[model samples]
Target: MKATTFPGMSLDIDIQELTPVQWPALEKLFGKNGACVGCWCMFWRLEEGERFQDVKGASAKQRMKALVAQGQARGLLAYVEGEPVGWLTFGPRRSFPRLDRAPSLKCDDADEVWSLPCFFIHKDFRNQGVATALLKFAMDTLRQRGVSTLEGYPVKVPAGATRVANSSAYTGTVPFFEKQGFKSVAERPQGKQRMRKSLVLRRSARKQGS
Candidate 1:
C-alpha cells in the first residue's frame, strides 16, 4: 500500500520534536515488555545479548533518557493529535553498538553519516506508514544538516523464510527501505538487507569571488 489507502487517518501526521520531556511517552510505548522484551528497541545494541544482557529494562531507559539530556536528539516522533504513536531512531551509526557488530554494515567509514537504525509504531497506528514518514523526516533533517550518506539494515527475507509475529528480526524488511528510496549497496555480511541512500547534495558556497 500507499498512504492514501488509509483515509481520515492522516498520513500528514505531526512529526513531533523529540525532547527529554517526551521521554515518558516513549517509556510508555516500550512498557514493561521492554519494548518487545526490554529492548527499548536496542536489538543491534548488543551482540546476541552479551553487553545488554546485564543492563535490564529500567536502567537501560535511564541511559537513553540521559542521552536526551546530553543533547542527543533521539530521532523523530510520530504523533496523532498530540499523542505519540510511533518513533524512528536516526543518528550517527557509531553511537549504536548494534550496527557495529555487523561487519557488512562497515562502521569504519570516517565520512560521518546518519543511520535509520530502527522504527517503533504503536499497536493502534501501525500499517499506516507512520514509520515511513518519520524516516523521511529524518532524512530531510539530515539533508538540511549537509548529511549525504544514510544507511538502514533491512531484510533479504530468504526464500520461504517463515515470518512470525513481532518477528522484526531486528533488521527491517526490504520493502520498507525501498519505499524510502534506499538501495542495496551491500549485502548480508553478518545479517541481511543492508540498504543505503544518497541524498541530494547541496553545493558549497564559494569563498567570496573564488
Candidate 2:
C-alpha cells in the first residue's frame, strides 16, 4: 500500500493495486448502484455488439469479479481512514476492445500503449484530490512495470464551467489529465479527448544511453 497526504488535506490516502484480496473493498466502494448504473467499471471492457443494459446490473458485477479472479483486470483503489473512496482502472489497450470502435480515438502504437479508461470517486470524496493521487500512483506503478506510454480518454468540461455532474465526469476531465503531463493527441466527438503521456524512456533509448 502507498500512503499519500495531499496539500491542505488532513487525511492520509492509501492506494493499493486491485487484487482478488481487495475485492471486498471494491464492493463497498462501488455500493449497490455499481458505481454509476451498475457499470462496475466494465463499460470499456464490453465486447462488440454487447448491450450495456444486458449486463448493467448483476451480470456486469459478475464479469468484473471474474476478471479480478483471473488477474485480467488492473486498477488502483484509494482509501481514506481504511475506507475505499476512489478507484481507477487501466490496462493494455487491447484489454478494452471497445476503444477500437470509438471513432478517431485509435492510435498507431496501440500494442505498446496502456489505457486508463475509468475513474470513480465516492460522492463525498469528489474534488478532494483523490483522483489525482490515484492517477499519480498508477503512473508510478506502470512505469516501474516497464510501460513506456499511457493514454486516457477524459471528458472535456465546457469552457467557463467549474464542474459537471458526477456521471459526466466518470472518465475524468481533460484539465486533470493535462495537469498530469498528458498532452492532447486526438479529439473524439462529444467533448472527449484522446490524451497521451510517456511514462518511461523506451527500451531502445535506455540501451543507447547505457
Candidate 3:
C-alpha cells in the first residue's frame, strides 16, 4: 500500500525512520508547552517522582535531547513541506518505564511486544486525522522491524463525558483504536485502558502455552 500525503501544507511528508537529527524537529513541534506543558514525555520514561522538577522548562527538554543523542528514535515524525508538524512516540514496552508500571497497561503475553507510548500532534493539526495516520505509520514502521504485537492506552470515554484536554496522555481515544483494528485486550481500573492490535507478521511461539 502507498503511504499517505497531505498536500495542503505541501505535505510531501517523508515518514522515514526517525533519527537523532529529527529529535529537534520533534521538540519544535511539541513547542513551549512541551506539547502540553511539562511533559517532554519523560513521565513514562523517567523514574517516579524524579520528573517533578525537571519535566518543566529546559531541564526536561535537555533530558530528551540526550536520549536522542543516544540514538533513540523513540517515535516517528510527519514532516510537511519540510517542517515537522506531527509526532508519535512508540517503542518497546519495557523501554517506557511508566506504562510498564501502570496497573493495566501491562501485557499478558511475554513476547517482547512493542507499544505505542503516545502522541503529541501540534495543536493546529489536532483534528486533521493526523493521530490515526501516525498510528498506522508507527505500526508499519515497527512491522518492518519484526514486532509481533502493538498496543496503546487510549482514553476510554463513555457516552456523556465532557471533552478534556488533549494532553491528558495524548495517548488517544478508544474509538480511534477500534478504528485501527485494536480491541480491548486489557482494562484498567482508571479511565486509561490498554487497547491492542496483533500484527500479522511472525507469530509468537508463546501464543500456544504448550
lDDT winner: 2
lDDT of 3 by residue, 129-187 (tens): 66766787788777767787888888877557755467564888787889988988776
Q: Which residue pairs collide, candidate 2? A: none
What order do candidates take by TM-score, descending?
Answer: 2, 3, 1
Give a tens-digit lDDT track for model 1, residues 134-196.
Answer: 777777677777887898877666666654244564456777788888988776633466688
Give me the displacement of residue 147 in model 3, in angstroms.
0.4
Q: Counting only residues 3 or more apart in sequence or on different chains, how many pairs clash (N, Cα, C under 3 Å) in candidate 2?
A: 0
> Model 3, residue 84: what's the lDDT?
80
Candidate 3, residue 59: the lDDT equals 78
lDDT to native, each model: 0.69, 0.88, 0.72
Listed in order, each prediction's TM-score against the native is 0.80, 0.90, 0.83
Q: Give candidate 1 regions above 4 Å deviation.
A: 1-12, 43-50, 107-111, 161-164, 189-191, 202-210
Quality of model 3 by C-alpha lDDT: 0.72
Clashing pairs in 3: 33-37
Which sections of candidate 2 miss by over 4 Å?
1-10, 188-190, 201-210
lDDT of 2 by residue, 1-210 (tens): 445554445457888888898889999999999999999988989999998989889999999999998989999999998899999999999999888888767888889999999999999998788999889989988988999999999898776788767888888888899999999899644576899999877689779979
Candidate 3 steric clashes = 1
